[model samples]
Target chain A: MAPKVEHEMHYRRLGRNVGLGLSLFAFVAIVFWLTLAKVQRGEPVEAFDHTARPSLETQDSGN
Target chain B: MSDASLQSNVTTPAGDAGFRDFVALLKPRVMSLVVFTALVGILVAPNPVHPFVAFTSILFIALGGGASGALNMWWDADIDRIMKRTQKRPIPAGKIAEGEALGFGIALSGISVVMLALAANIVAGLLLAFTIFFYVVIYTMWLKRWTPQNIVIGGAAGAFPPMIGWAVATGGVSIESILMFALTFMWTPPHFWALALFMNDDYTKAEVPMLTVTHGRKSTRKHILVYTLLLAPVALATSFTSIGGPIYFAVSLVLNLLFIRGAIKIWRRDEDEAQADKYLAERKFFKLSLYYLFLHFTALLLQSALGVTWGGF
Candidate 1:
């Protein structure tokens, strides 16, 4: 077995990986915050749930 | 060679793109302009947006702008290689492949539009989508190489950010947003033509058919002055709108006078004089055009912040 040494290329690749990881993490955080804000504002957080709901019907009719 | 060395060599191929290379594909400078104008749009709107929502919406808008830039780089790679000014762009520099840029652009465009729709409203999402399409398809693909009026129409893509920001806040368009659009739209030709006057060789080398290249420098200079004359009214008209105030009006009046003065200077210089001084007047006008827009937008932001109204209007 031989000792492995780090190369300059390894540092570059690591930096890129860290950057990508942080970007994805930030994106997820934004989505979470947005959902929280929307819910807090009392806006109906509706999505296609594959089942009918009276709330959606009432909201649609109101609109 | 040792096994570790062989493995490292295999993993890090020559010219492998770093994260910065991908960021370069986004054209951060242009994105800053988009972010600033869009932030002004959000802040100046009649209705207020939640701080988080505004932040996310702006992020998505900037991403959309970056996507357009990537697509533009992909499509313009051939011309970019020929032009000295654009020769070091990501695709031209071989840091990123054209197909990679295309895919990256497409993916970001979709994500930004969908996220913006969820974060703000559908209208903002659609406007961002249209901006991306206009810049990539209408401007970059069609208008750029085909006509001298390329920038005139292509400028609309750049102008849409504020409108989208207003839509994010108000969930619709209004007179203020339209005026903001008009301000940027009318200002583009003169800004770009001033640049064209100074960088005439880049367009000539790239066969881009700029006003200077197609219509001749003399005509281009005349066009700059004419557009500046027309732009002044639009710039001033915004001062009378709801977004306008004493500060905005005062700022706009001074900037417009300076802008028009610079344009007249550009219009007056012949090639002999321009060559003697290396297009000093044209260069100064181009630099002032930057401050001209920045100050105009900043003044609008100030008006919103001060909550002042134009009593004359």
Candidate 2:
């Protein structure tokens, strides 16, 4: 539990933060664009093609 | 070739790279399993997540898992330092400080939960948050110190990833998701017990109350056999859901049979016999258990991809 002072970690910390932030931002933008596309096409963004489970559709809707 | 020559070649001694230590605290190996199971959960769901959103969701889920590892390391530093296998971890080895790991884990826990909520759905976010809390608070801080059933209850925390992954796409739980969760939950005890049979001394020395330490190796072997037997039915049950198919059933049936055979072998061995064979049953069973879950999930994913159903769906 000894407190180690920051000495040689400047660039490493900065690079790690920047990389994570950029990845998050890029993914957020892509998800937003996809959502918008679904909106434009008049589809529910949350709705999925449940073609394989035609029987489950009624159960899903009932729920 | 005296002091002057050595001085001329002086190089700056670099401190340990904090990033790698940070990643170590996250327990990348366990994080990979979390990511894989969560991915399978998403892929096997009847509803598909948007690829971009799914990627983001999985990343945050992995971070949540990593967050648990960090906090667990922080809390278990004492026991970790005592055990030979864990003595070299970031916190115990002094590669990273205690306060740093605690702060890092707390920050990532908040960030992952919030971002997952935004990118996916409330259910997935809430489940991820619960998973972190369960691991760090309920399991690591409590059961692990007090009881031998720690792995049994704490296993639920690791079991949540697939359920969260399913929630990310469907925003709700289903039989398939529940079965996936059950599969991991049931598989954990036997998998870990096999490891305990080999590494019992470490747990005993640390006084960690592992099954091998508290219940005796014979009882631990019996528990492993029972859990493996229980796991087989659950693994097969998934094939009756949206995720299961002929391939999944075939692979899982064979794997389960082999696993049962291995468990029985372990159950019958005594300490002397185990020593005679170099704990061969435990070691081999442990290795097979790893593949047992992976192949079952892999077969599930294959069936999901091909949209193959044996009239179950």
Candidate 3:
């Protein structure tokens, strides 16, 4: 069996590139989302209107 | 128990541990704060989010918060083993191996970030990722043991949820969300320092250099009062935002007054009085701080839900 006495846990041992990549990915993804999504028109979803629908009585007002 | 026996007891492979042990590693209590604040953030946004999107986003955010907690536990296993308050945590209690916690934390972090990105836009995902990184790397690994100002600065990690929630709905940050973040960031110091007063011995034992251990109780008291004073304006200021209304204003005013009153009581007490009273005031203040956050956030929620208008900007 492999050695069990020690466990690998040092985060600093990872390459600088990996850290840079991770940081860049996080920031770039956020910026990209903001620009791309904010600039474009989003699909409109209808919200339930509490007070604005026309009453049936209004349709026969001419009578 | 013997050293060898103790080592063998806790060093069992990951499969030997129970499910609750795994859950314990996630720090569910802290995750609840994250979930609640994030929900507030999403709800307070200028745009309303679909219930499904809100649910999915919050679930991923909680997972990310949990991931940060697991990683924190893994990194802090040594200190956790020593501290009375944390000695029973899965790693320190010998139920889960450090390696397993480490692996689990990393996996959850990755999944939460990626899934949040897909579920909502990438800003929410990125914010979640950043929050995890800050808690795990910046606050846990670096600031925690290094400085007496640990809670002061590390509070940012906890403060980001509302911003992330806002990002999920609007896909960006704003002055309003920043104020929401500031409210939590400012509140963390006095809240934690109150606990530090009562639990100073535990931190001293752990050698974690909490504000109380590094600074004397008198200075810690002064610091608590000062932060509370600073916190009042920010807490009240949120009432002028879009999310704030008449209900929020009334609640914020009362909570801030109570918070200031508690801090003043803490500031005025000496060690003799504290020992005689068994730190009762400090404990009461700490408890009030918890309600303080919940009530203030809940007030904001009430304003949004009930459309309480007179005080709204």
Off by over 4 Å in 3: A1-63, B1-11, B311-313
Cα displacement (angstroms), candidate 1, residue A27, comes to 0.8
Tens-digit lDDT track for model 2 on B1-313? 3332232223212233356677888999999999999999888887867777788889899999999999999999999999999998988776676777899899999989988897788999999999999999999999998999999999999999999999998999889889999999999999998999999999999999999999999999999999999999999988777678888999999999999999999998899999898898899999998899888889988888887679744
RMSD of each: 4.4, 6.9, 10.5
TM-score of chain A of each: 0.57, 0.50, 0.36
lDDT of 3 at B182: 96
TM-score for chain B of all predictions: 0.95, 0.94, 0.95
Q: What Cα-based lDDT does every candidate model obtain? A: 0.91, 0.85, 0.86
What's the fnat for candidate 3, on a 0 to 1 scale? 0.00
Candidate 1 per-residue C-alpha lDDT over A1-63 given as tens digits, one digit per residue, 9 for 90 to 100: 223434555666787788889999999999999989988875345543546566557655864
User: Candidate 1 residues B1-313, lDDT tens each?
Assistant: 5554555533334445678988999999999999999999999998878999999999999999999999999999999999998998988877677888899899999999999999999999999999999999999999999999999999999999999999999999998999999999999999999999889999999999999999999999999999999999999898878888889999999999999999999988999999999999999999999999999999999998987775644
- For model 3, name the residue pairs that clash: none
Model 1 alpha-carbon miss at residue A4, Å: 13
| Candidate numbers, best DockQ first, in rank order | 1, 2, 3
Candidate 2 C-alpha error for residue A38, in Å = 7.9
Q: Locate the minimum summed-lDDT window of 10 residues in model 2 chain B.
A: B4-13
True contacts kept of each: 0.53, 0.14, 0.00
Native contact fraction (fnat) of model 2: 0.14
TM per candidate: 0.90, 0.84, 0.81
